[model samples]
Target: MTVHEDVGAFSPDSEWPQDATEWLMLLREEPDDAEIRARFEVWRSASPDHPRDWEEITHTMGVLRRVTPVVEVPVGRQVRRRSVIQRIGLGRGRVGLAAFSLAASVVLLAFLGPDIALRLRADSVTGRQEVRTIVLVDGSQIVLAPQSAIASRFENGRREVRLLKGEALFTVRHDAAHPFTVFARGLTVTDVGTVFDVDAQDAGRVTVAVREGQVSLGGIVSEHSPILLGAGEELSARDGTTETRTVASTEVGTWAQGKLVVHDWSVSAVVARLSPYAPGPIMVYGKTLAAECVTGIYTLTDPQGALRTLADGQNARVVHATPWLTILHR
Candidate 1:
């Protein structure tokens, strides 16, 4: 009997059965086979929760089999196997197999939904206060800002990037045969051999700023015309409304150089942008103080000093409640 020890890592407290589903699927396909049953017994005893999850899954499958009837499929008839699994009930072993298939699908979906699946699929991620640059297979470069995540794929004459969170600046390599496209926050930005910055923050808020060349921006939610942008162009989109304007091309992606240039941006917005660079949380107590706008180029090398400069300029009070907490009040 051969035992496969190469099964991936498993956490006892994980919400879903990790590698156990593989064992279950194998058993379901060959229930009467003794080898798989023996291997499953070995795997089930490896951890305490493994047996508990297996028993619960078995109970669920039994309940499903009791309620669902199997339909007969004609021999030599064309039918989708996945659809057939839900409709057909053979003998005891086949019924258990079908039940297991249905239960496994539900378990996997509940455990690894869209967000977790994306995080798992991401090719690279940047932590807080960390910036990373990745050179793609096609010679394109992407600089990921703090706390950003991205997945890239180049196949079938197309280059694609899915930005999961935070910001990224793309310096695309011109490939006429394979156009580069970026997906983020229900929006798509297709590169036209240009350098552009994409900021995908919380609540479906996204900002795309062009530093060179041109690109097309469109919403994934509705059928809308693509907004074209050139050098020094900027577009901000939130909820459903989108606004486009002009910015200094040289100052567009200055954060990559350890500087942040803001032109008359509100204090809250400034704090929000700086929070990613700060070691801890920056909270604004008063709405009026947060709404006050300031314009300047701040050095990210000293986040606390930048905060102090903003506070002193606006006559606002900076309270250091804790080493990790900075509060601003008017």
Candidate 2:
């Protein structure tokens, strides 16, 4: 059995019995085959989970589609006269590369929509020290920072949103039957007549911070706790362990107003929080620089400016590798 099958396959062709990856690749070469086509339909309709997986595949295809439109090359540049030797070798290589690329594209297309929708978007933020608010199409709001992205799809029975990457605070509009749901890793945060924020980061870690109303979080989180969270309450789960803690809701809500406040926070902690706002890496070279205590409230629009302001207070010099990377040394 192939690894995907050995591990339990999602949509493998049982007749051909190809691995999930290979099955996807075959669709490119033989998309018209009735057996493959029927099997594909069966796989998608087999369970509720299949459509979600398919959505991820479609989003990735969108990325490739957008990227493929822009290409620049000088056409018909005669570096050398077309010789028989050059033609034979060049043709073979070109055909091989094309076939390989096509196969890869099909597999990627299978998981593109849902996965990419959950991860990439028109805009995204990561490791931000400040709380940033994003306005959605249906007049809802998303407060994102500290490695977060929010993607929305106005679908029937649900105005759905997939938090593909990072952490985000969601203020959803009230809809009884058509609830707004946020998907993160293995967990799903569904609003139960309320507004909440969910922080889903790398390593299956998730934090649900509620402001107004209550939310129900599902998945095998923890045995000791209930899944419901009310205002001023937060749920944090790392692997199998889960805990709920009460915090100042107003403090977390500060992101909605475009402010992030920090007090006596370690440089590592600050960087961990701040990295989400700036698009690229924010790293400190020395322990002295990395361990410094930071205290302040700053706007999301200007992270580098915030760094400069912080440097001025500490009497330190700020050196930036690029526009996005900053390093402070005394």
Candidate 3:
């Protein structure tokens, strides 16, 4: 039997668990690299504990594979992966280079149930540090931010897209005969021949910002009398409350261009926006530190510098520069 099926055959020594896990992730990332395989053979023979540690990871992955194997992010375009969570803890941990959440997949899967379910329903997904532009059959364009997913349904002469996770900017093509609508959370943004950005990243909030033209927001707020937003206007809906504010239209969806624009956003929120582009996890500790507000345009290409600058402004600091993690504390 294969290594995965014989988990009982090997009693894991746990001596080189971390090393073995890292090696497994690396190998999966470069399975065809003969050099890496050769080096792995050398390391495997270095100690007997190594074999058991490696076997333990195989068992874990095998279990996960059997339980929830593939995630098909396919419709009519190209996708990066079709299995496991791309970033965060597992799938591509150590900041997208290795895996760290496999051992804790069961616990994480519990917490990530909703997101995993969303991924299963998604038609397009952008992994960590990936930004993708999809052109539909109607010539409309969709720019998905990092760690984002969307599912589109174009039937009955109407186009509807659901923002599964993260964020996306839609540039709709004018179709008077057909309507284009985007759904997120409990809000529906119906395009009025316009370009708009929908963000569902903030906790319990789906933000709609119009870059050009107008869009009516229905659902949660009555489809009969949908709220209308013009160019340069933005709306945020959360719980039962809705808030509207005006921002420069040019600044909307700048994250797709490697710049993050935030206004009066909490320090914790700003860091959350930066985490997808970062090489490691960015942790903001303490409620007091998390509550402070920040407003400015930060460079996403240099996430480290941006976080440091943001922290400096709040009299806070970012510690622990581990390649896979960053900690922010007062």
Candidate 4:
């Protein structure tokens, strides 16, 4: 394999990794052949994009492995396009392997299909560094925080919003006949014409903070009683346990204003909140450092800068392993 010195600057239309699917197909067809493996290694090393393309292909394969039962395709039967499609249950539609270029189709179906489904189902979704306000057919409004998704339905004499992921602030449109509700993390938040924020916390936990009017929080299980909250009140529920306390309205859902306000929160917890706004993964190494309490209002506009500030305040060191990976250590 002739290594190109200007491989990184290679044209996107180049033939190197553009033929990645063929390479993958070849590897699948002859996995035990040392000669083919050696040539693949040479081709992969010939350009920077080659490994990236291969990583994407492998990632798609991993997704396919998880969704489907069959793991390994037999070397002899790998080239049998119909068998592969039947195994993955893609034979139902007209989308057979014959309809598309083999490797490209596999990658697209495995990777982009799920995302397209999610986007189609979601009424509103926000990416990192984006705060979006969406108005429903009714007079109700939602302020979706970064990396959040919500599906809204205003049918059958009911107003409902499902928080599929992340946090959202809902300002309900008061209608006596239509009750407004938000379902998140296996909990239900029913509004009494209120402006409130619901956070879908990790480990099936949820936090509901009411800024105005009133709202009720209840678990999906019938045994769990509903907790009614008024203005300046907040409720945190997890694992059949619930905690309620008074909170300042100013502190609820302040991320919409490019600010993150936390009071006596652990470093790990704060990092979890900031992860949605950060460009990539933010990790904390030391248990003690992660456990340490932090209280401050950090700007969300510059997540990396805010992280460095947090590290300085906690007497920790910030390490950038890559442009997308940040680690905080004591």
Who wins the TM-score comparison? 3
> What TM-score, to 2 decimals, does candidate 2 have?
0.53
Per-candidate local distance difference test: 0.69, 0.57, 0.72, 0.69
Instruction: TM-score for candidate 4, please give it.
Output: 0.63
| Tens digits of lDDT, candidate 3, 113-211 | 236676789999877667899998888999998888899998889799999888999999988788898999989989998989999987798999999
* Candidate 2 local lDDT, 1-330, one digit each (tens): 433343343433233322222233334445565655665666666568656545644454356446534222222223211221132233311111112332232333322333444445625553434456777766778877654566677756667777767667777877777777777766678887677877765456878888889887886563345388889998888877888888777766565565667778766566555555554445443456567888888665666676667667766555442343344544
Name the candidate, 1 or 3, with the larger TM-score value.
Answer: 3
Each model's backbone clash number: 1, 28, 0, 0
Q: Highest lDDT: give the candidate number.
A: 3
TM-score of 1: 0.62
RMSD of each: 20.7, 19.0, 13.9, 13.2
Which model, 1 or 4, shows the larger TM-score?
Answer: 4
| Per-candidate TM-score against the hidden true structure | 0.62, 0.53, 0.65, 0.63
* Higher-scoring candidate on TM-score, 2 or 3: 3
TM-score: model 3 vs. ground truth: 0.65
Q: Write candidate 1's Cα lDDT for 125-184 as tens digits.
A: 776567889999999999988778998878888799999988899999987777899999
